[model samples]
Target: MASGMFDTPIVGVVNNLFGGLIDAPVVGRLVRRGLIKIRYVGRRSGKTIQTPVGYRRSGDGVVIHVMSPDSKTWWRNFLGEGGPITLLNFDGADRTGHAIASRDEKGRVKVAVQLG
Candidate 1:
């Protein structure tokens, strides 16, 4: 199997653990200090994907930095500057929002989700 195959499972396991902890009471608060969970449907496969991402609230929206823009395709779902997204906040509230993805000159991807 390719080397990338190994990372898939590890990432999934980590995400699951973080997702669970972020939904808990006390631990969730601590975890939310640096990460937030984002749930979005695949653009083509139509699968629901949930991942923990680093984010910060900006004005009326949240900003998430996508580490590598080219290798990751999930961010593509928000490329059109509009798409449904469920943001699992640190406070244990699921916030509905519209997400927009953009890439800077440095190749860093930034997703802005406008909360409803």
Candidate 2:
């Protein structure tokens, strides 16, 4: 795996645990901040992919900052003209949106979603 600061074995385990907790029954509904799952089809493989990530509300939409972008491939599906996405919003709703992924000069990656 790539050597990003968050690309450690413990980090992966912690992320999985948190993902499970965030999606747990009853209590999952109470997670109204920080965590969310984004679903989208693989642009190349044509398979549906879903993963949990952190997000924050941005005006009329949401912004997902892709941590360790160099070590992750899921965000690449939204490159160029971008594509459709389904976000498991903090409200416990599957919100549809258009996602566009971009990388800045500093190598920070962000997927901006315009919820519909």
Highest-TM-score candidate: 1
- Whole-model lDDT per candidate: 0.81, 0.83
Model 2 alpha-carbon miss at residue 12, Å: 6.3
lDDT of 2 by residue, 4-40 (tens): 6556688678767877878888777766477887889
Instruction: RMSD for all candidates, in order, please.
Output: 2.8, 2.6
**Tens digit per residue, CA lDDT, model 1, 11-85:** 778778888887778788887887888888988888998888889889998899877566567788899755899
Please count the clashing residue pairs in each candidate, in the order shown: 0, 0
TM-scores, each model vs. reference? 0.84, 0.82
**Per-residue error (Å), model 1, residue 48:** 2.1
Worst 10 residues of 1 by lDDT: 1-10
Score candidate 2 by TM-score against the native.
0.82
